[model samples]
Target chain A: MAVYTEISDEDLDGLLAQYDIGQALSCKGIAEGVENSNYLLHTETNFYILTLYEKRVSKEDLPFFLGLMQHLASSGFMSPKPIRAKNGEFLQEVANRPAAIIEFLDGRSVKRASPQHCGLVGSALAQLHTAGSDFKLSRKNTLSIESWRPLFDGCKSGNPVELTSQLLSEIEGELQYLEANWPSDLPSGVIHADLFPDNIFFLNDAVSGVIDYYFACNDFFAFDLAICLNAWCFETDGSFNITKARKLLNGYRSIRPFSKEELSFLPLLCRGASIRFFLTRLYDWLNQVDGALVKPKDPFEYLKKSQFHRLVETVSAYGLD
Target chain B: MAVYTEISDEDLDGLLAQYDIGQALSCKGIAEGVENSNYLLHTETNFYILTLYEKRVSKEDLPFFLGLMQHLASSGFMSPKPIRAKNGEFLQEVANRPAAIIEFLDGRSVKRASPQHCGLVGSALAQLHTAGSDFKLSRKNTLSIESWRPLFDGCKSGNPVELTSQLLSEIEGELQYLEANWPSDLPSGVIHADLFPDNIFFLNDAVSGVIDYYFACNDFFAFDLAICLNAWCFETDGSFNITKARKLLNGYRSIRPFSKEELSFLPLLCRGASIRFFLTRLYDWLNQVDGALVKPKDPFEYLKKSQFHRLVETVSAYGLD
Candidate 1:
């Protein structure tokens, strides 16, 4: 629920002049995508999403993000293509912020993921990886295993009363284990690091669209699956649903078969993924911006997910043969 | 920026079952209407606004509000018509709150109003009043002159540090004068009690839609005009633009001619309208909810507006003959 920057009528008209999508009929601030201010833009021709990149997103990385969408979209992936301006550029400036007009895709993100939904999500994730394999631009995963310790130290420096001594020790132990055992020889490509349920839309029992590419970067393909395992395979009571996990992994392997090394490193990567989210969530929870519209997600949930992954020994624990 | 209630997929499907508007394709929470949760609902058929009435809006008043919109839209006003369910009910319950599906109206609300926009707004407001005159429902303006004193008392009880002693005394004196002098007899009808710039939309130099009718109620026709005078005629620098006010009044009179008595009482009603807004804003400012998404508006701005209206002696001061 964010609309950090309010665009004026003149500025909006100025933006529309750059595109040939007809005159603007309406542009409403949509309560989606916390990292950027998104407006559900309606033009005389059709609907599009007008996004103003907020401070959280680096302007230099926008080319990679927008370019990746264009690449995936042209490759027959479910990503919504960014509408190019008359100058043939996908990015432009609006209200002193980099803005883009994106094609509006029709699909609703599920609040609760069923096993079938998990299957579709898995297939879609693998497809995204396959489609972006040939993309030219590359960005390093800034929140992978290496950043976890620094993020944890930053979290600890805040003196968060919520971080009990026992919890702190648990996080430290998990960080050390993940850093030592993390696999480096797995197949790597562009991975949607934040492919949470809310970021994937479904229609007619299939994944209709995958969005919020701000977190997309070069990382181990199996690590992306690890993130999904933490995000989609867990129930409200903090119990892991192996059925959903199986469906997700099976669905992915069907699209792009996982390597032997990828299969072996699954549990450790899941642990790494959990800590990555946990630390980021913890950092946000501690350093929340004043009057931020988005509520910081509970970090303990990720910690519980991490604990679950710590108990897993092999791929079979995830319902894989 | 509000999405107080999140509708689950199952719940959304259930709600859609009652309506013949086809299956829900997407429902994104829209950052509009502070009092209610609004979703820009896209179905297989078309787009609509699905609003869940929050606690701020009284449940009992839903019929009057929805019915007024139906009446106005049917009478060819720009108000968005509420879509009735197959059961012939315009309202239903979703997420345990009263909900309604409304036809999506196209047009962007202006951040900065031009004199032409002000004129269009005036004509639209008069049209709304005329169209709603025969509607068989009446809702008392809850924040009218009768409620101002109580509202002011509530604000004072909070002991707001921002309400200086001088400002408090000035408000008290204004309240006393308004209560004593508020006219008892004027041409009355349904009024859009809150016709701020954000509530009106324009396209191609014409008013395309009028929305957020939650504040509509039975009140003096001239008092509604007074509200507009305060809202649309003010520049950002706190200076009143008389040319805009003139255009607004002239545009309004072109639709439904104002009575001499209504015109004579305009300045005093403007002062009363200012106090009404000032008190409510002050009340909200003092008793802000924790983690509220919408920021409470500055009450002193209305106080300044009230002071401007206080010195006016006649309707001619409003650029009227």
Candidate 2:
């Protein structure tokens, strides 16, 4: 729900001239992506997406995001491939911001993802891991283990415990425990750290496309699965649905089997993922700037989720053997 | 810039069940309309805009707005026609808000509108007035001369003169003048009162569509022209460009010739139009709600335009006679 940068018509004309897509017919700011300004661009020939990277996105990490999409597309994945310019650069400058044209993928993100949708997303996630294996670039997961404390410290001055009675100390305890027990050896790969339902498009009851790779980074492949478990398997009432979890994990396993060690690390990784989202959402909730277009998501949901994950001692709790 | 309502997939599926547009493929909230939550809905057959009317829009006036669009579309105008439900009603309920699916018009609004764009808009506006001549339903312009005082009073307590040196007294005097001298008879009809650049779309340099008819009402057709004069003729530096105004007036005259009375009232209508926008913008500026998505427009811009219009004594001042 953000379109921070407005690309002018002359700028768009100049941008379209660099590509073979026919003359620009329309470019509308899409109220979808929160991290970057996205436009649904229509040309004489086809519909494409023109994304302008905003302040929150790291400019240095864009090559990894773009390259990951290009690599996935080359591997016959249903992701938006960056359209190269006349100079063969996938990234170009528009309105002084890093902008690129992406092939438009048809389908809509499910609001309440069904078990079948979760299954498709899981299999797609596994496929993405396989496709991303041959990619050369890598970006460290900045929001992983080491960054949680600083993020929590940034918002601790506001006394975030007001959101929940045990919020402050609960987060502190989890931070200490995760820092001490963070996994060192696992099958690490490019992971979509934020593969929420909003980023996964389902058409005709199948995963049509995987979009929004801004949060893609180098992390344990199982960590990515753990993130999806937190994202897709929970019902709106703060309860875990075993059917969804089992279906998702089964779908992922059918494509790329998880190792015994990976399965063992799943509970800790899921707990970490929960706190990772909770801390960020809490920070944003506590310190939302005036007149921001996006409504800050409720951090308390993640708080409840993290609390639930704290009770899970084994993968069996998530409907996994 | 606004999508105040979020329509869930279940709700959307229920809504689409009453339509013959085929299964819903995608619905992305569009960052276009400010008054309503607009989603670009892609079905198996065609594309449409799912607009959920927000609070600012009066629910009672939905029929008039939808009827006006239906009338204009049937009259061969390039406007979004409201898609009727299987129950034969254009307006339906979605997420507890009055919602409708409008056939998506294919064009883009110009950012920096050229004089040629102004000319096309003027001609299109005249054509709209002609097409809307027999629209059965009628709505009063809620922001007309009678409403400016109340709107001004809403912001008067803030000592709004601090925004510009003579803002308070100027608005006060202009309010009295406009109220006392509003025209009694000058070719009144259904007028698109807010035909700003963003509301008019161009394709291949021709006016492809006119939209955002929320401000459409039964008013002096010349008043509508005056609104366009204020909207299209001003440069970013706050100077009124007579060339653009002349081209606009010429385009309008080419379609429907103005009466002498209409011509004589152009300056005052233009002045009244300036203040009408000034008072509303002033109200919004002085009383912006927290967490609102759209930024308040500068009220002083309209104040400057009103001051410029105050000096004009005859139609020739606007490159007309």
Candidate 3:
């Protein structure tokens, strides 16, 4: 509701004039996101999403996030291509906030998806992982398993549940298990690290686009598959739907099959994704300090999710294949 | 690692002088926290936590966060008392970071807790809820039940598995069930909205203290019990540990007995806690962007755990008359 610092109509038009996508028709703020201020705009020619950087995002990382979108768009993946300003920069200052306009993609998020739809999502993700492989960039995953130990240190400040020792020991053991058995030399590429249900859009039964590249970074392709497995494959009852998982893996293999190396590490990657989100969510929950615009979601949920995923070992996923 | 700005030792000493505790000790940077940069500073006087507000926290809400700490401290709760600077301000500019210092608490987080420990936690929590009943403040539970829709909105962005729609609808039904059956006038107090294992501390097999009141706000005390039931009473595999629940309830009742109204609301409150954490975790998992020093944990574990808690519509803990 704080429209005080948002971009006005005139400024929006001026920025759109620089892009080759014709003139602007209409633009309005998206009321949903807790992190950034987004505007869904309908231009004369094409739809677009205009986003203003919020406090949680760093100005320096803006280029990577924006450029990756542009890169992915040009690479044949369906996404909002970052528009350049008249000055040829993808980023511009509007309303004193770092802003950019991206080609809006049209798709409905799968509602009552069938197994076929889940398979398609898996296939689409695999293709995306393969497509992003050659992109020239290096973004070290900040939430990698190595970082888990340092973050565990914060839990020591106070004993709300004395989980630090248990969590740390358990996590350390997981890390050791992971280090001993991590999938190395699996097709590395730019990964959509946050490829949850919201980031993928479906045009009818077909995947029109995968959106939200802010968490996109260079990593193993299978890890992205693992992320999809946890997000797109789990049931509402928290049960691992193997029927959905099988279809998904099949769909992924149709585009780009997981090598033995990648397949071997699927469960660990699942654990990593699980633990990473768990720890972060817990940290956010306990800290209880967030900017006005950014609502701090509870971290305990993620911790719980990770713990659940840890129960599934590699043997469970591949099943002595 | 990104020490974009530096804090002088002298500047810190001035900040430390405000606390009425003994003498100063050493302040060491805690490398972990994803949201804020925290340092453990021990003095000849007492222990304290010096946190430099990171990009995630708002400068405007510093007063709310800082004042809440001071207020709770003054009200004889276990919270860090923010020290006012020479300018009579608790907020200070440190290394281009809006920072404040708080008292470091003693005790260890219970890692390997037994049914007895959970019982102690339950009792301490209820007593704490009683203590916070008359605290002067009206901060809304920003992460309340109403916030679940937006989280679901975020989750819906992706092509989740075939049953996602089923799950969402199921969750919506659960929310409505809670709304209609919600027990009003059930002992309102300042509830610790986030009461996971990692947040509570213990010492010498006794309840040492409860810290982290950022989520503390006016809500049903039964909601607090539900949160604990979902957190402590669950097994490692996320199944409901019925015996542990009895122990937890017994322990809480020994300190502060639950009212008839409170008892009736536990089943519903448990469901609410389960869904709340479930959706929040899923949202965080999907929305995770990069360049964070700390990791964002997954919410699925809590969601899964909540799903289990949701299954038991009746339990002996309620002592159904």
Best by DockQ: 1
lDDT of 2 by residue, B1-321 (tens): 888888888899899999988988888888887889999888988878899998989999999999999999999988889999999999999899989999988788888888888888889989999999989999998988889888977886765345444767777888889888989888999999999888988888898888999989999999999999999999999988888998899999899999999999999999999998988888888887777888989988998899898999998888875
| Pairs of residues at least 3 apart in sequence or in different chains that clash in candidate 2 | B1-B31
Worst 10 residues of 3 chain B by lDDT: B1-10
Q: Give TM-scores of the second chain, every candidate.
A: 0.98, 0.97, 0.83
Better of 1 and 2 by lDDT: 1
Give the winner by DockQ: 2 or 3. Answer: 2
What level of docking quality does candidate 2 show? medium
Q: Model 2, range A1-321, lDDT digits (tens) per residue?
A: 888887888899988999988998778888878999999888988888999999899999998999999999999888889999889999999999999899888888888888888889889999999999999999999998889999988887765345444766778888999999989999999998899988988888888889999999999999999899999999999899988999999999999999999999898998899888988998888887777788899988887888888888888998886
What residue runs in model 1 are displaced by over 4 Å at the alpha carbon?
A158-163, B158-163
In the order shown, the chain A TM-scores of the predictions are 0.98, 0.97, 0.85
Estimate TM-scores for all models.
0.98, 0.95, 0.47
Task: lDDT for model 3, please.
Answer: 0.67
lDDT of 3 by residue, A1-321 (tens): 111245554576567667676665434444324467776555656556778877767787777788888777898888678878778899987767888887766554553456787888888787777667666766877777677767766754664555556766876676677667666576787888887766776654688878877777777787777777777776766566777888888888888867777776777787777767766666666665443333455565555656776776663553234
TM-score of 1: 0.98
Error of 1 at A244 (Å): 0.8
- Cα deviation at A154, candidate 1, in Å, is 1.7
